[model samples]
Target chain A: MKLYNYFRSSASYRVRIALALKGLDYDYLPVHLVKGEQSAAAYASVSTSHLVPTLLDGDAAISQSMAIIEYLDETHPQPALLPADALGRARVRAIAQDIACEIHPLNNLRVLRYLTHDLKLSEDDKNRWYRHWVESGLEAVERQLAAQPGRFCHGDAPTLADCCLVPQIFNAQRFDCRTSHVPNVMRVFEACMALDAFSQTQPSACPDAA
Target chain B: MKLYNYFRSSASYRVRIALALKGLDYDYLPVHLVKGEQSAAAYASVSTSHLVPTLLDGDAAISQSMAIIEYLDETHPQPALLPADALGRARVRAIAQDIACEIHPLNNLRVLRYLTHDLKLSEDDKNRWYRHWVESGLEAVERQLAAQPGRFCHGDAPTLADCCLVPQIFNAQRFDCRTSHVPNVMRVFEACMALDAFSQTQPSACPDAA
Candidate 1:
């Protein structure tokens, strides 16, 4: 398996954690997002969306972190990322999408660049933009977990939601986003970070870490 | 089952299509997005994100259209929203997330409102902001579908990918985003609309549609 990734990409970080948890080995192929390498024809051939964390398992090429991670779970079917039931899977996917679809998209590198260059928002304003979405998105996540959260986002064992949450908290701290307010998230994040799987795949520790 | 929906919400529309495909009966409780009903405490209880398309099934409340749809699929199990195989499921999920996570967030109501009211982008500029993301997102979606697209996004049956693609195309056309380019998408959109499921749930046909 060949994993096309960027060290700091929370999306790529997700796939890496899933791989580690499943104990599957894959060669890391970095595609730097900041340098416009993802837009090149060679990379575009593999990743149609020109995004990082494209996984190729022989002929099965996949993009979108949640999708890739879900695919990995489906194929491997050991140490399952999703719980056995429907409601459990929904809870996990909901938590994952709350970050992937809501928080991360608004503060993505491209969106921030647009805010600064095209919309003429200042750096401080851009940071505010980042913090605003993160705070709100995580607030919703906290509410969702308020009922079901245990040691992990769902129960004691880590599920797919935890895989996504760990990386997001990593990025949130990187941007100096408002973490002090989200204690539930902070607690769970620390728990996941304590795990060897998550800690080993931390952005700074990646082979292509800048 | 009860679905908190807005007549024209693209996200809600996706869930509605999935419900219809799964042949599950649901009470379509209209929550007016434009009227700020989603933000109301009643709706927000079920939807922490304060977004439309919250599915309340018995004790299980699900948010996020993709998550909700998958839950429905898991419970129903006959007309599976996902493809049968792992690689096939990955392709479908990648197609869905390419729209849900990547494109939809950038063009969502909050972002548009922020662009216009907060930063004071001109109406034309706001339209440009809407069109810019829509065009590029659809183009990327087109590329994702170019290789394996059949009668629907995956096969002859309408999988989860088609459920997502139809609503997005509907919104793109509503906003007058570029459409003459992606012939494959238009064909699939037409194919989906021919069914009672897609046709009946359309914005114009919905009860709250005004």
Candidate 2:
């Protein structure tokens, strides 16, 4: 398997964490997002959306980080990323989407670029936009976590929710988003960061990191 | 099952289509998003994120439309929303996330509100921002559909991908985004709209639709 991804992309970070948790081995093929490498024809052939974290398994190429993670879990089910029960799976998926859909998309690199270049926003305004989404989105995650308190996002074991939460928190801290409001979310982040699966596969530790 | 959802919300419409496809009945408890109902304390207690389309089944209150649809598929598997195999499921899910994560999140109500209200962009600028993401996002979907060339998103059957696609295209048309660029996507949209599940549960057909 070859994973084509950027080191700093939260979506890419998600797939990396999932791969590590499953104890899987794959070649890390970096597609640098900042350098416009993802838009090149060669990389575009692998990813339809030209987004980071396209997992290539033999002849098959899977895009979308959440789908890739679910594919990995389905193929390698020993340490399941989702719970065994249907309702449990729903709970975990909702938590994952809380970060993936609600937070990450608004603060995407392209969206930020549009804000500054197209809309003519200042640097301060751009960073403010970034922090606003991250701060509010994490608050919702905090509420969810408080409702269902656990060592991880779901249970004692780290599931898909943890895989998503850790990366978002990493990006949030990078932008200096207000983390003090989400104590439960921060607690889960601390627990997730303690694991080798998360710590070793983070952005700075990736092969392509500056 | 009781679904607390807004009529025109793309995410809510996805779950409605999924339920209709499965031939399952759900109580339509409308949470009007435009009226600030989603932000109210009563709605917030049911949905931690205060997002639309929270499905209440017995005691479990599942948030996130994708999660709700998957939960419904799991509990009642008459007409499965996902594919039978892992790779097939991955492909279907990737198509679904193509809209759910990439396109829909960028054009969300709150995001658009921030663009005009917070950033103070003109109405035309805000509308342009809406069209930009939708047009570009649909082009990516077109490329994926062209590669697959299914009667639906996956095969002859209407999978989770189609459930997402139809609502997105509906919104695209409402906003007058460019649909002519993606013939393949429009073709699938036409095919999906022919089905009762897609047509009957559409935004206009909903009880709360204005």
Candidate 3:
């Protein structure tokens, strides 16, 4: 198996943690998002969407972090990334999407560039734009953590939500979003970060780390 | 089962189509998103993240349209929303997330409101922002459809990918995006819409449709 990834990509970071957690071995192939490698012809063949973290398993290829991670979890049943029940899975996905769907999409590099260049917003305004969405999205997630958080984002063992949460928290911290307000997110993130899976997959440690 | 839905919510609409495809009988309880009813205390009880399309199955309340729809498919196994093989499932999920994770999040009502009220982007600029991202995202999706698409976004039948595609296409149209560049998306969307499940569950036909 090989993972087409880029350090600093929260999406790629997500699949890395899942691969590490599953105790699976795979080649880490870097595709730099900043260099426009993702949109180039080489990467497009590997990923039709031209996105990072496209996992190649034998003859099969997969993209999208959540889907790839879920693919790993489903294929490797033990050390499951999801809880045993349906509702539990729902809670996990809801929290993940609170960040993936609601937050990260707006703050990603492409959108930021669009704001700065196309919309003619300054850096200060762009960062402010980044922080506002992060703050609001995290607030909703923090409410969920306050209500249902355990050792990780869902229950005691690290689940699919943690795979998503750790990356978003990494991003939240990188953006300097106010984590002091969300103690539960901070706490769960600390727990997740303590794990070898999360620790080994940090952006700075990746082969593609800039 | 009961669904907390808003007529125009793409997320809610995704779940509605999934329920219909599964032949599942679900009571729809409209939560008016435009009216801020989604954030009201009563709706908050069922939704931890204060989002719409919270599926209440008996006593189990599930959030996240993808998760809820997946749960529905899991429990009712016939006419599966995902393919049987891991690779097949991954392809289905990536296609779904290409829209759900990357595109729709950026163009959702809340984000549009943020672009307008918070960023002070003129309505024209906001719509431009909407169309730009929507068109670019679908262009990538068109590349995806070229390789794996059949009668629907995946193989001949409507899968989870189609559920995501149809709503996103609806949203792009709502913004008056350039559909000529996304013929594959338009094709899949029209194919999905032709189905009774998709047609009946459409935003215009919903109980809360304006």
**Best candidate, TM-score:** 2
Local error of candidate 2 at residue A126 (angstroms): 0.9
TM-score of 3: 0.97
DockQ of 3: 0.77
Model 3: clashing residue pairs? Answer: A81-A160
Sort candidate 2 into its docking category: high
Q: Which stretches of candidate 3 lie over 4 Å from their true place?
A: none
Candidate 1, residue A191: Cα displacement in angstroms equals 0.4
**All candidates: CA RMSD in angstroms?**
1.2, 0.7, 1.2
lDDT of 3 by residue, B1-210 (tens): 999999899999999999899898978899998889989999988887788889888888888888888888878888899999887788888888899988998888788888898889998999889989889999878988988669998888889999899988888878789999888888888888889999999999998787
Chain A TM-score, prediction 2: 0.99
TM per candidate comes to 0.97, 0.99, 0.97
> Runs in model 1 with CA error above 4 Å?
none
Model 2 over residues B65-149: C-alpha lDDT tens digits? 8988889889999799999999999999999999999999999899889988898889999899999999999988998999989
User: DockQ values for all predictions?
Assistant: 0.82, 0.88, 0.77
Count of steric clashes across candidates, in order:
0, 0, 1
Clashing pairs in 1: none
Question: Which ten residues in a row are the worst by lDDT in model 3 chain A?
Answer: A85-94
Find the candidate with the highest DockQ and give its number: 2
